[model samples]
Target: MFEYLTAGESHGPRLTAVIKSLPSGLEIEVDKINKELARRQHGYGRGQRMEIESDQVLINSGLRNKKTLASPLSMTIENRDWKNWKKIMEPLQLETEPQKLTNPRPGHADLAGALKYNQKDLRNILERASARETAARTAVGAIAKQFLAEFGIVVASHVIQIGNLKSESWSQLKQSANFDLDSKVEFENYFAQLDQSPLRCANSEQTKAMQKLIDSWQAKGDSVGGVFEIIVRGLPVGLGSHVHWDLKLESKLAAQLMAIQAIKGLEIGAGFEGASQPGSLVHDQIYYQPKTGFYRGSNQAGGIEGGISNGQNLLIKLAMKPIPTLAQALASVDMISKKAVSAAKERSDACAVPAASIVGEAVTAIVLAQLMTAKFGGDSLSEIKRNYQAYLKQLSEF
Candidate 1:
């Protein structure tokens, strides 16, 4: 039910997002959405764009008195830098023809998108392809996050690797600390503190090393990418179905997480590593207790088994490639001149792994919200909560 669409350009007047459906009576705070937007802009290696744009959501419709009305929610984030580009990016007629871009950047949509759309100017392809549109998705996800929180569901993420430097993953941290994986507050506190870190990494030594790596790469006119982990707590079992391929929870999460720009790889729990181990060692063994109901000693399955949630904290990891735009442009052939030329260099980050982690959290929240609404159908928040409580009772009795 939390389906949404986003539209905007990197340097356009504004970005827009429309959430098609949501339960009525869900309270939404504009400041919370703005907070998430600000979180997206934080992190080292960000470009001038972050400085130029202080993103905040402007609600257009589908809300009354800060509560949902079960209608479409429309929002916009004004691009403050649009003032400088108005002449070139004007929607209608212009007094003079704007300079057309012919060079396509490596590892970007410029070439393929232009070929598919039959456009000579690469800007036509790059504007929408830019990751700037994720700001709108972040705004939409902020609302979904609030809705999830009402049901005790929470989502968070932290960067684990940047360039050659690596830090502890969620599972690794739990094991090292002999942590209680079931403690929701501990999980929240741990990831919450990461927001203060420049790289959003837990290890101070690794964070410093990663920062140095980014600086080294930037000085060399290169870019770097890394990995992050996402954690979701307080999810109920059976939100997804085992009967359908598309209905599988991991499939849904993988599809959305991989769609984030620059994301090149994904792993759920012991993903690739588990494949190399024996089944006896890799599989999570089952256990039961009167207080906790069905449980597992390990989470190698990432909280989902047989395409349905297993009531454990959901774990996901994503790998982002180096940002395509670089200070030292790569060799490319100009589309118009049909001659070798340097790739286009846009204002970009030297490393964006920390920022991408926030986007990962937002996307994960959106997917879980969609599945939650699908599993417990209702038109209002109270109705959904009742259904959710009933489901918990059923699980307890089983």
Candidate 2:
């Protein structure tokens, strides 16, 4: 369930998303969806496009009286900037020749996309390739988040690194704190405070330094990129299967998270760092209690063991490369002219790690929602809840 697809382009009339499958009788809040869209635009180093567009989701089908109807849910987010580019972006033939972009940006899809589709204009390739498409995704993920909330599952993220500066990771922060990491209230409160921060980072001093780094680079006509972590809490022990490679939770997570624009790398828990540690140090030790059932003392495996969720908080880290568009563009050869030229410059952020963290939360929610639906397997929210409760009861008895 929760199968979906997004359509439309940056600067187009509107971005459209169709969620082809979802359970019935789930209540959805439009305001919450809009709130997520607003969060995606609030980061400190966002470009002028954030100012020009205030995104809102418009429901087109499969919903009535705020409840899902068990059909394909469709939504749209209008691009406020569409008015300015209507002439050049008309779907039908244009009355006059539209300007074509020949030079491709070095780190972007411009060159390869054009060559793949055999297009003369780079705009054709870039329109859909732009990260603007993530708005529709954020909307879909908002609904997925709502679904997860029904089961008491929460997904959140925070920026940990920007350029060369770094902040404590989730594991390190938990170790330094005196509170219980398993307490849902404590965990939620921590991330709630991060929502108020400009960089979505818990460390105030590091956030200020990160902002200074962004400012210095922007002044130099350069862009910056960094890393963020996604943390999921309240997952059951068996959402995925070990029988098939594709069914592994990590594989699903890596495939989806890596699909986000500008993302370059991914890590789960200790990940690459665990390579240098001995087996005894890197592996999480198992323990059993009558009240809590089976558990782990640490989560070096990132909440999954043998391709299934281990009822531990899921931890994932991702790396994003600098935005391809720059004030001083990189050198490139014009496809049509066959001469040296600077890459195309577009309105862009000096750094977007903060905004990307919000995106990470939304995306993580979507993947968990998918797995939950698969595990519970019901046509209605109430039915899924019944199945989930039964599973918990079974686990307790075991």
Query: How many pairs in model 2 have backbone atoms within 3 A of each other, for residues 3 or more apart or on separate chains, i.e. clashes?
Result: 0
Tens digit per residue, CA lDDT, model 2, 1-398: 88899999897899999999899999999999999999999898889999999999999998999999989999999989887888888788887988899999998999999999999999999999998998988999999999999999999899999998999999999899888767989998999989899999999999999999999999999999999999999888997789999999999999999999999999999999999999999999989888767778888999988899988899999999998899988999999989999999989988888888778888888899999999999999999999999999998888
Candidate 2 TM-score, true structure as reference: 0.99
Compose the digit string of candidate 1's lDDT tens values, residues 81-113: 887988877777866898999999999999999
Please report, in order, the local distance difference test score of every candidate based on alpha carbons.
0.91, 0.92
After superposing candidate 1, which stretches have Cα over 4 Å from the reference? 178-181
TM-score versus the correct structure, for each prediction: 0.98, 0.99
Give the root-mean-square deviation of each candidate in angstroms: 1.0, 0.9
Cα distance off (Å), candidate 1, residue 387: 0.8
Displacement of the residue 149 alpha carbon in candidate 2, Å? 0.5
